[model samples]
Target: MSANADRDDRDLEADPASSTSGPVGVPVDAVCVGCGRTRVTRTSLEAMEIDPRVDLSDLDAADCTSFKHVCRSCWAITWRNPIAILTGLLESERGE
Candidate 1:
């Protein structure tokens, strides 16, 4: 009945995946696809010893490389060979 409650209802309906607790509904801290390292929100990317120079645009909306979650190390490696990775993703989408 209240405005806040109405908003909550709308949000729940809009995103069925939302949750009040845990990693299921929230943005995860940075994850390294290369080493399978999961960083929580408290740790800075630099503190994780991740490369700051790596461009993260190749990572898709889900914060993944080629739609697959990768760590900073793996991202660094993949970034070095962008053409191959992009071509592979495109090819995969084409079922080639």
Candidate 2:
């Protein structure tokens, strides 16, 4: 089932990132760092290649994090375009 992104991670009773549902149903701990929304769903590393906006080619396979979360707003507005989100991530990474 599609998760409700509006829910707070702190209140979740299960580990949403886990493949199997936890004690309190899938625990929702993933909140979008971009929008502070809980709408981000974890995507496998293999799935990243399918997304045109994401570029993992430069990074080593072992160094790359297995999970990627693109929030609704980012996916729709910034991430869908690639360059926009890349700039955003770069700026954020630079502590700007």
Candidate 3:
């Protein structure tokens, strides 16, 4: 292929409509209450848009200092052993 042909094939401007490719300016924090672990990541705006159907009562936390984020790994572990996770949480709270 000629140089001109290659230049023509290349894109001059990025598609702003593309949500997948761009600077990850949006921040997302996921916290696991049981182990007290936090996972912070930057993603696209579209990825974090709130869904009306989802009840975000936690968003209105009175103190505004609460643990509502949970990493995917922790969620998976909870699904596999919910009783163990819940028990551990309770034990930690009781200092037992």
Candidate 4:
């Protein structure tokens, strides 16, 4: 197996959160760090690539850790034209 794959396997084995049952001892209402979306359980947030090491015990509904939550339309637009979005943001910033 490739190095990265091997490493991932090791990490999976070592991390309790990566287990099939999901993160043990973690809160159920943790917010996703990527999309700022609240996941009622670790399994729900697992789909967002959240690091298992991040603390979720004191997570609040209003906290946005990483601006991770984007509506489907916004995600689609971003995937379709990242450059266009950046250009628009730059233009707006420059008042042009």
Q: Please tell me which predicted candidate would have the highest lDDT against the true structure.
A: 4
Off by over 4 Å in 1: 15-68, 75-96
Of candidate 1, the 10-residue stretch with the lowest lDDT total is 78-87
Q: Which candidate leads the pack in TM-score?
A: 3
lDDT of 2: 0.37
What C-alpha lDDT, on a 0 to 100 scale, does residue 56 get in candidate 4? 46
User: What is the C-alpha lDDT profile of model 4 across 1-96, one tens digit per residue?
Assistant: 599999998887777754644433222344444454444332223433345444444333233222223334334211110111122332354484
How are the candidates ranked when ordered by TM-score, highest leading?
3, 2, 4, 1
State each model's C-alpha RMSD to the native: 12.1, 14.5, 13.6, 17.3
Greater-TM-score candidate between 2 and 3: 3
Candidate 1 accuracy as lDDT: 0.37
TM-score, candidate number 1: 0.20
> Please, what is the whole-model Cα lDDT of each candidate in the order they appear?
0.37, 0.37, 0.37, 0.37
Q: Stretches of candidate 4 above 4 Å error?
A: 1-42, 63-96
Error of 1 at 60 (Å): 22
- Over 16-54, each residue of candidate 2 has an lDDT whose tens digit, in order, gives 545332221211234444665544243333433433234
Determine which window of 10 residues in candidate 2 has minimal summed lDDT.
77-86
Q: What is the lDDT of candidate 4?
A: 0.37
